[model samples]
Target: MTDDQTLADTTPPAAHESPAGGVFGDPTAAPLQPPTVRRQWSIADILAEARVPERYARVCLRADLEADHERILTELRTLIDVEGNIIEAEDASLGEETNTARAHRLNDELEQIKADMAKATWWPRFRGMTSDEFAVFNKEHYPKKDGASLEDYNNQLVAATMHEPQVTPDEVAALRKKLGMKAMSNLIVKATEVNTQGGVDVPKSPSSLQNLTRQ
Candidate 1:
């Protein structure tokens, strides 16, 4: 045989070619994609993801009732000295009957004050919403009247935010009646603060940290 013909006869086929002359690999096959990377969350990221921010406030429905309670406590202290001894007048002018009557009256007043106090104090808890939720809430509830002043809009917003408490309308109404406008407004302020600020102690920013560490 001729040298060129002999070489051609002995030559191996291309790696990608089949014995029957068809291509061994599919050229139309999709290219291999990079592997997906699993995200590694930091402690702060995990905390933020899991956290449901909340704020709490103690509201005094009746300041006068608290003052009355303190006053009664003082009077009781005077009637019975620090050592638990009853003090008597020099002339016994204030007789046993008078002292007993005074003691009974003070006890009754103190009992009444305690009863009033049970209804006078409230610990209202407020929860902050996610940004998406707050955006939707603002869109749905924010005042958009043509003639509404800034103060009117703010008041409406605060009221809407405070009403987020999961109570019935009747319960809210009763609380409002007892709290008066001033106390109710204060609650609204607290609610707004929590909702907007997240009511959490945030880690200091890098700039603030640098400032704190400066000599």
Candidate 2:
């Protein structure tokens, strides 16, 4: 199993879990299917379950690392939670904490979970399981296409929660025109000639921008 997949195994199922809308807004808006659960097991737990001999386990582990080593390693260093906003619930559900306070406190909790999880020895010892046993264990657990460990699964969770949805190529072009996030910025012109001196303080015409850009 991959590290992220293996890492996810550490998280036991919550007795009663519910969707908590976080930084990315409503979960319903950009719905991606959820990752399947794989129970987290300790080193001994893995050994007891798998019947593989030592040599083959090492080979299986090494091969997985070589396939996507850099990307996998980089993901480990990347923070899983969104910047600032860490509370795993909707704003209304938060009850009293203001948005600013919620962000600050959630940041602390996310950092601590990551720090403690780092010390767990799930990945380093996977190399010891027999390939025969690994195949059996892996089939039952690491089902994601490229998944080889729990860490990969954790990264997937992070991706689902925080990764922004992609805009299509056409949509990107349209948004660029609207936001003025383009190669060449232009000074907006108003037909009424409001403050013709180009005073920065005056309100720029939002309604006219699209028409002017298309021209």
Candidate RMSDs in Å, in order, are: 32.3, 28.3
lDDT of 2 by residue, 1-215 (tens): 21322223223245333354433233355544445986788999966864321110011212233334444334433423555333343545536655446455555555654454444312211112234543454465445665343433222222222213422334433433443211101111110011112222333333335356778
Against the true structure, candidate 2 reaches a TM-score of 0.18
Once superposed on the true structure, which residue ranges of model 1 sit more than 4 Å away at CA?
1-40, 43-48, 60-67, 70-88, 94-108, 120-123, 131-154, 163-178, 196-215
Model 2 vs truth, CA RMSD: 28.3
**lDDT per model, in order?**
0.58, 0.33
Kindly list the per-residue Cα lDDT of model 1 for residues 1-215, writing each as its tens digit.
Answer: 11111211223236454343233334454745645986887999977776556766667767778778888888877777778766655555633555546767898999988888777677777666667777887776555764433333334444445533565434544555565554655565555665566534453343334456675
> Which candidate achieves the best lDDT against the true structure?
1
The lDDT, on a scale of 0 to 1, for candidate 1 is: 0.58
What's the C-alpha lDDT at position 209 in model 1? 49
